[model samples]
Target: MSSSLHSPWQRHVPQIQRKHQHWLTDTGSLTQKLKNHCEQFVVQRVRQNRAFLNLSETKSLCLPLGRRILQRQVLLICDDSPVVFAHTVTALERAGRDWPFFNQLGNRALGLTLFANPLVCRSDFEYTRICAQDALYQIAQTALHTHHFKVNLPRHIWARRCLFQHVRHQNSRMMVTELMLPEIYQLEKTSKAR
Candidate 1:
């Protein structure tokens, strides 16, 4: 029941279900994998604003002394049901120069752009459990309410994160965190029953 977002992100969480671990460790394109999970996969953009990221995020992205960064949050919806919550942070100063398409990705998955670039290199995946008090969990709840999704999310969720860095300018990179929402398991169950 750890409520801190600063909880260490590990390579694996042995206590979670094997199914949950499957999704967390998949290094392939998440946007593509999600497309196969439902008839329709959509990226619902929740918020994209300038703000200071939490300490963990700031350090992961290697941002300068508490500088403002671009924070974008989205819910990956499958057949109208939200399945995953995603948060991304890029230094506002270098965003356009480094992550040129980040600001233009309206409802499109950021994974699409990241995976397509040959100049970008991704680091290893790190796993984390997000409890109710964590900002990420709170954002997921708010997204559910705002979108009027009837699904009841759990008090905690499992999320994985990694950094996408520019091969040319190593310091210019973005950190992406994705949380598998509870409804995702429901969808998996229903799909298996079919």
Candidate 2:
């Protein structure tokens, strides 16, 4: 007789579905697809800005392989916002598998940024622990943690999505999107090239 639906969990259905969608989207997209998009977007932007690199555009950047390259170096940019509720390390691992070169080049430098720093939080602790177990390149966080590789976490922008609109200031954004990672690397290359 009432206007309510028969479903018991209907009230939370939207939220549950949203989370599932996010997971599926992130997991379904491959790293190469992300990297390719990033390359095109970043290159176009750089060209417009008069700061483009002269790398071999024809040659596809084949990512390295195995533990040798894996131990070479890596820089992980994590926008560790509580609202971005998804498995962080697990997702990164999948990305690595998807793009062996991207992960191998980093060797193991993992960088993290939280939207809001939390003290004694279980999520924070677990994130750190999982990253360590993964043999990350290096783990840096805003929160105090006793690690041999701790460094001053850099400024980063956080957003609900990785699109340009969702991104804030480029100079201070975390840029956690898998596609954007290569763009970040390209920028670093440009800086060095300059």
Candidate 3:
């Protein structure tokens, strides 16, 4: 189930825990899954801004260097607890023309929109274990700090990303990433104990 995505010297690939594997491997709407699991599921928009794409992002979206994109961050809240941190990016021009709702979708689950739309097609999932040195993880850590939502991070966090393309619009490419927060593990443990 594990293929070498990074170079050998980059650090041995982290093993996926059994509990997390089911969640991570599910390709269906994560928003729905969270809703089904919790009594109350909410989407809290954390950040939505225009910024230059990172190297990994630029490559994923097949965009040239120095191109700016609309970046969004959201926390998936289950039973008033933040269980997942989601990040997404789309080209600036495509944000309006292709995804007209991107700007207007405040506190709405992006997964629902993408999955419900008939025009959108998702790519295979790509996963990575993020640690202190990962830029994206650092960004998430800083955001959680400023928001005052205290959640301690484990040594590594599992993250998955995929590209969603609009069948009608050739250039309509969007990359969505979701990170499993430590709170998610706690949530599962608590539910099982009940």
Question: lDDT tens digits, residues 103-183, model 1?
Answer: 899999999889999999999999877777787787778888998987666777888899999999978988899888887
Give lDDT: candidate 3, residue 48. 97
Better of 1 and 2 by TM-score: 1
lDDT of each: 0.81, 0.21, 0.79
Candidate 2: which stretches are off by over 4 Å? 1-24, 40-73, 76-194
- Rank ordering of all candidates by lDDT, starting from the highest: 1, 3, 2
Best by TM-score: 1
TM-score of each: 0.90, 0.19, 0.87
* Count of clashes, each model: 0, 19, 0
Specify the poorest-scoring 10-residue window by lDDT in model 2.
42-51
lDDT of 3 by residue, 71-172 (tens): 999989888788888999999989999999999999898899889999999987877777766777777787777677787677678887888999998778
What's the lDDT for candidate 2?
A: 0.21
> Could you tell which candidate, 2 or 3, scores higher by lDDT?
3
Evaluated at residue 161, the lDDT of candidate 2 is 21
lDDT of 3: 0.79
In angstroms, give how far residue 180 of model 3 lies from its true place. 0.7
lDDT of 2 at 128: 14
